[model samples]
Target chain A: MSGAGEPEVRLLGSWASPFVLRVMVALRLKVVEYEMQQETLGNKSELLLRSNPVHKKIPVLLHNGKPISESLIIVQYIDEIWASTPAILPSDPYRRAVERFWGEYIGDKFSQVIRVLRGSVPGDKDKMAGEMFTALQYLEEAFVSCSQGKQYFGGDSISYLDIAAGSHLAWIKAVEKISGIKLLDEARFPNLFAWADRFCAHPAVVDVMPDPDKLVEFTVKHAAMCAPK
Target chain B: MSGAGEPEVRLLGSWASPFVLRVMVALRLKVVEYEMQQETLGNKSELLLRSNPVHKKIPVLLHNGKPISESLIIVQYIDEIWASTPAILPSDPYRRAVERFWGEYIGDKFSQVIRVLRGSVPGDKDKMAGEMFTALQYLEEAFVSCSQGKQYFGGDSISYLDIAAGSHLAWIKAVEKISGIKLLDEARFPNLFAWADRFCAHPAVVDVMPDPDKLVEFTVKHAAMCAPK
Candidate 1:
């Protein structure tokens, strides 16, 4: 299906971008062939610039030379274009809207994770941890409602919500280990905790995830760069 | 299509919210009958709280008692469920995805408008105006590319992208009046300027838009509230 004259798939991405990993996971899940064009975040390539002029961020999915930027949008595009079995998004529009709602909720948590990491000093730990725990409670409820005892988030198969959450799972573990924030403890967020395990174990997501140690190191470095020096 | 046995549509919205007006515009465009459940944002009603616990903000669309929060999400939901005649979102998934991409871009501008408002002062006028002008230039290009000699954003009919842009048009004018930052002047942004005028002239969007004078008054009041006293 993806022979010459077919759509040429190239992923312009950086190793540090969870957004990039999301496109990778989606592509793998759909069994779409693509080349990963690595781009540094600090010094983005001219190709990356030409691909995505809007935000100029990475994880640009280049299909037949047309680039789609924004990680979530790219994931949806992949879901639509690839149109393989085990659709990540549900068929019914209402159900699709619900999955998208969860995706937006997960995206919101991404920013909160950054704030938690940045403000993870000893004095601010309790406050940040409290916020993180409250947010996790919401995610756990979302998982419980969607899963109904299933392994993944909304269904037995990894749905849109699962991928949305999966993108952040590695970061959660790395943050928990680095900041001692206890993001996804099984005792507290059992449903989500289990969901994370199932998501990461998938070959589609497993190999693409950044090493936890390297991720934490990068986070620390980013935090230092952002510090009010 | 929407009648007895169908879940009653109740909108939790504030008169001040452009986001609320967005849902209102979409619903009106679809000719769907929905009761406006006005919300006082400061002392939010329990319905608003329950419907949108995450943000606890206005513009939650309740259909048959099930709630959908987030303006754009509600817009898409409205477009989906009320698929009788005039389709706001395009049917083709690629076209729909492109519409969504622009919707996200316009939404991004909504926040930048707030930042410009908060940061605007006599000393910061040129800098703020420059940023606003640059953003408007992008919107102009988007309209030119998408319209392709059409009246509305996507076509002659009011589209999802047009609704996205229209929701903020009233506020954009009000902000310019209040801050005196010429954003969509015809010389710089002729396409966007013409588009805004057309969007406001639409019967569905016309009545629902917050009054310019009142909107400016509210915006001034809001700026005062945000100032570090």
Candidate 2:
């Protein structure tokens, strides 16, 4: 259906957002060409606001002018619309459900851990680090079973879960560097540690992922600004 | 493939949980035969713990020994595996994405609003009531667009978004009764208000829905138990 000429695809995102990186990775993985618009936080563009009235956040995908918001939902929309080789989601429904479960897990559980590590949420750093380790340990077990002895969670190819969790790679590194927290310990979470490396190095992800050093600087500055007067 | 002589389906849930009610509605909708195991709070069953090791929450659907946690994920699994009439999600991917966006909105936004209303999270009741009304207003707009003048978000059928938001109907009512904070104001959110009535009365949902009066009593008792002496 998209053969009605190349679909006009546009992505609204910021430079450092991991969520935006997710949409970028998906587009690159699917080989879909799109125009990227950089958005500045606190002074959002009207288009971004209009596109996603509910969340009013970035990484809204405009497919031939119809906007799809939410990073994961937009990725799914890309996967569905493109419908080409190298599917983002698995073909089987059960497998798809499993992927979704982990994706939600990454968004909910791991995201909170990252927030704690970044000092975005006030918490005992030691306690949060332990919680982070426990969550990654769970994901390590999940990767072993879900990957089926493959390189990525998608099993030899990048898939939904990969993009979902993988998008947070730079942020993970940045948080670890800034907080002196050893989260992705190779010995403790060997599978997840390796997967993180592979995911960051992937063709679709390498160019798009935020630099860990720059992220550290940004996160530190942002945290300082947000601290009480 | 589930024709492997009636797959053993069991649902682990607590009676008062809206999340649990979602799975119940989905099963009833699909006409899927399932064993319902009631779990008591403070005394969770080992099966419940084993089935959902991560969140360790109720509403875990055990399908032929494979456990799927999370209410929405379980509903999708049921829809996929059953693959029968009255699909929970829309067939078109774009439409599915739209429904998913709203489903997630209900879970994230509406759920938070409800939490505030219940006094579960300490907050000014007036501010939370305003937020609850604002969220409902958004849903009202979402229904108008998504429903396309149809009776339900699924367009003539009670679909994913319906079950997701519908499960919380009793809780919404109970909060209204307990706090006297009106959320689903018919005058303001006519579409969603009417949709709520229709959703509650749906065959798949009616019997499984927790009684609003009972829920009010339970919520009050539970809140009292947790209150500071």
Candidate 3:
């Protein structure tokens, strides 16, 4: 707290957010000390509003008062600022882009996931599940590409891609159990299944995970809001 | 024709697509020479199919036989490889994140623009247009943050953010002409409206614009498909 001239690093985040956890894990991975101010979802704090006026969402990392939003963007920024720490993205430009391609794919899957979880219509639940499976297969292929002869997505160490997709593993498992849908079937996605297990077990990753009971409670409560009107 | 050592660069893209133009302008700005292999929308080629197996979509930049898909990702890759050329993203991580935030906002507006253009339903047309305005106002604010008494969103030189958002100007203008709604109104978005003109007139940007009449014709043809059923 009393470091001379060191920039005050603060995180405006929510315990309910995996995106927030990504930044927290990234910060912890680098051993960067930061203060956390938990944010209420519905009634956001004025500080967050001032920090990230655009999205008005959490996981905004304030570096000496300047705010950086978006989970992937924040994680990358963390890696860059803490250059002394192990690199999250590759040094090579081409490799970085390839990593970024898969990292960005997590965003690509959002709509399909929402449709899958909520169902386009309550009656259309089965139809949307098919679409979600097709989408999950593509993600499985992405994970497999870099998992060859390696433990993590980045091979030896955790990467921006791993943090990008791995943050969702907790939520996915919670959804799977609550919804009773075996989306990440062990046989269909052995690599991703194992990757999720390994990601959750990582000490830094474990530090950011939400309480198990609270997570299930959240998914149950939010299912109606997620469902199509 | 490339020299012996120069990597063989190729772009698999549809002339009708705006995303392809983003990569085109980026390459031109960097003075990187690349051959364009046009792709038909409905009928994709084997090269494109093999290159980008994930999204099977266009604007894939093939570098030395290795393919990089997603226009924004490709643009960053081009910036990285041609490092000496005028940088697209800033060298500073914080600045780069801020820029990425705006670049990413373009994605947020896509659905709003579609809803505005296609109309969710006949009665819902006006409501969608209002949402588009609220969205554009945010983009205008983003531009103002970086413009800072300069010509472009990137200040003097075009940037990743500039290419990301500027690529859509033609579509916005075309939509304005066809719909007569004037989404980017001069008084409301003084900076962004002028930016559209300046961006279009840039030599590199000019080289990538589609045939005006062809663009309008394609829009007319696609209206029925884009409309909510």
Report lDDT per candidate.
0.78, 0.87, 0.79
Highest DockQ against the true fold, candidate: 3
Q: Give the Å shift of residue A182 in candidate 3.
A: 2.3
For model 1, residues A1-229, the per-residue Cα lDDT tens digits are: 3567655899999887777888898899899888887886478899888877877888788887777888888888888887878788876666677778878877776656644674543345667667777778888898887777888775778778778768877777787787766768899777778778788888888888888788888777876876797
Give the per-residue lDDT digits (tens) of candidate 1, residues B59-166.
888888888888888888888787886888876666666678878887776656645663443345566567667777877887887778999876879988888877
Residue A194's lDDT in candidate 1: 73
Deviation in angstroms for A65 in model 1? 0.9
Share of the reference A-B contacts seen in candidate 2: 0.84
Q: Please give the lDDT score for candidate 2.
A: 0.87
Scored against the true structure, residue A117 in model 3 reaches a CA lDDT of 62
Candidate numbers, best lDDT first, in rank order: 2, 3, 1
Q: Write the per-residue lDDT of candidate 2 for residues B125-191, one digit (tens) a residue.
A: 8887887777787788889988999999989999898988888899899889878877888888889
Report the Cα lDDT for residue A70, model 3. Answer: 91
lDDT of 2 by residue, A1-229 (tens): 3446545898999889989999999999999888899998688999999999988998898887788999999888889888998999988877888889889887776678778888778888888788777778878887998899999888989999999989988988989998888888899888898899889888999999999999888888887877789
Question: Going through the candidates in order, what fraction of the true interface contacts does each contain?
Answer: 0.44, 0.84, 0.88
**TM-score winner among the candidates?**
2
> Residue B221 of model 2: what lDDT?
92
Candidate 1 clashing pairs, residues 3+ apart or interchain:
none
Give the higher-TM-score candidate: 1 or 3: 1
